[model samples]
Target: MVVIAKELLQYEKDYIKYYINFPKIYYKQENDKDYIKNEMIESINELVFEDIMNFMGVVEDSYNISSEEFIHINSITEFQVGYASDNIMSLAIEFSQLAGFYDISYLKGYNYDFKLKKEIILKDLFRESVDYIKILKKYIWVQAKTLLAELQKNEDESLYHIVEDNICLDEENTFYFTSEYLVLPFSSCEIDQEILNLLEFKIPFNKIYHYLSKYAIKNIVKKIVL
Candidate 1:
């Protein structure tokens, strides 16, 4: 089993203050533990710096008032372990802040292989020749239709077309996994709908078993059965 420790990184400046919460993962083997821990920290640091710079740009563009009229910006990052067992570990880090007239939220997912000593991407779990994007998009559409039906019950019919046009997996970080399901989390910003807060689609492993790579089948599928 992999052991995890919580670590907090805080940054403060003239108009910005934020706290980043991450995990320091460990294993029984010293070498393995050090390898995974170092890699995770390095990646997290890069993300944090990138967000800080992005926020600075937004703040500069949003406000023109003096320091006295400025509102303090506080960004908070929280992390959760979606699944961790054997050689596979999946983590989700969520960052939130108030920017301009919007509450901006971003989710970053990391799937690390302890044995491989590297982070996993979406393609890593699927067969090399499989058209995973097309397959996943089909599932997305099915879910969207169901959601549209629900919306039409109480909302205007115009939302149906809007949801259809905006729903898609534009990037890879939107996906992660648990023991029983593959999770796709789409925030309002991603779906291009101000009315929707978050739309999370949890696709069961059985639904996509045929497209899984041998490595994924052995590590994720079979391991889950036991």
Candidate 2:
């Protein structure tokens, strides 16, 4: 089963804004907006939990984990971050390892029923949630960089250069690129397909598909997927 990381969910504009602004909410006691906080929490719950479930159900017949697992992971991640205090990268690495393990295990069809039990233990130990907004921001940047690299390496040979902008292109082309673009520095948001379609470059679908598959397998397997 192909598991789309929570990072991908952040590509959506609303998700990016929420994650980026969440740290500010936590820091400001005077300007605290409970409504916005609650709304952000709700959005996180829906996007991180509900969307994961939907993806798993659609892509794989069965997923080992439950919504509670996500809650537990989030809670534990927050706790670890608080405890570590100064070690944000460590916290991110730990969180990434846990997420990767969960995804890999689910794909391998191992520990199908025990996932929730494990999550329960993690959640129970969590007292204060950590500020993962910064880490998420960094992660988004990384994704954007990776996406840009992929586009550069595998885009049609006829294509000279790729340009990315906030503007949406008309659907007169073969592929309809989603508004979901990654944050910059670590990763770029421009997809090659979008460039090809917009520039009217006639690349074969099979070649594009193969290139994407190879790229995903290489990067995901080597870096994020573990």
Candidate 3:
């Protein structure tokens, strides 16, 4: 087994009352080249810088009109390692922001194949012939309708229709994986916010075992013994 370490780099601007934290990873392997390590670190640095600049632009606009007492901003970044070995790394990074009355969060995941030195996408997990999108969409809509049923049972009738219309699978990129489950995240208002602050639907691997391609099985399921 190879040893890997994750480090958090913190940044704060007291004047704007904002702070940010992001991750940098290090590999403890004799064969690891300096250039590869440098490139990864540089990429992370660039991402962090972009995030900071984007948030600052939003803050600047809000500060122009909002009173100092009413202005408050906070950003929280966190990561979870789903699977890690000598050849593969899968993880998710969650970014949550609270600016005055606005509250938003996002989940981004990366499945990296060390041997190929490339990032994996959703389609890569399934066979080319399989209509993965249609299959995934069916399962997701089932879950959404289940939620709608519960809302109809207890919530007000008028609000139920409004919520139903907004429940949609807008993007296929909002997916990740853990050792046990395939995780999918929903936007804040995409579903009924009254039900959940963050909507993450986790489908167990056993539920979709046969849908996985050979590559996914070898790298993820077999490695995790699931």
Q: Which ten residues in a row have the lowest lDDT in candidate 3?
A: 1-10
Name the candidate, 2 or 3, with the larger lDDT value.
3
- Candidate 3: clashing pairs of residues: none
Write candidate 2's Cα lDDT for 1-226 as tens digits.
Answer: 1111233223222111111111111111234443323343344335434434443343222213443332222111111111111100001111111232342111100001111212111112112343223333344444445545766687666343333333223212112111121111111122333332212122222222222333223322122211
Stretches of candidate 1 exceeding 4 Å from the true structure? 9-19, 30-74, 99-101, 156-160, 163-165, 170-173, 222-226
Candidate 1 accuracy as TM-score: 0.72
lDDT of 1 by residue, 12-107 (tens): 766666676766665555445453435554664566557555755555454445344656666667778888886788877776665445566767
TM-score of each: 0.72, 0.20, 0.74
Clashes of each: 0, 8, 0
RMSD of each: 4.5, 21.0, 4.1
Name model 2 segments beyond 4 Å from true: 1-40, 61-191, 194-226
Per-residue lDDT tens digits for candidate 3, residues 1-226, read 2334455545555434544454455554567564245454356446655765575576556656666764556655666777777767677766666676676677667666767766677877777788876676666777777766776787556364433345465435767787677777775555665543456777676777778888888877754443
**Between prediction 2 and prediction 3, which has the larger TM-score?**
3
- lDDT assessment of candidate 3: 0.64
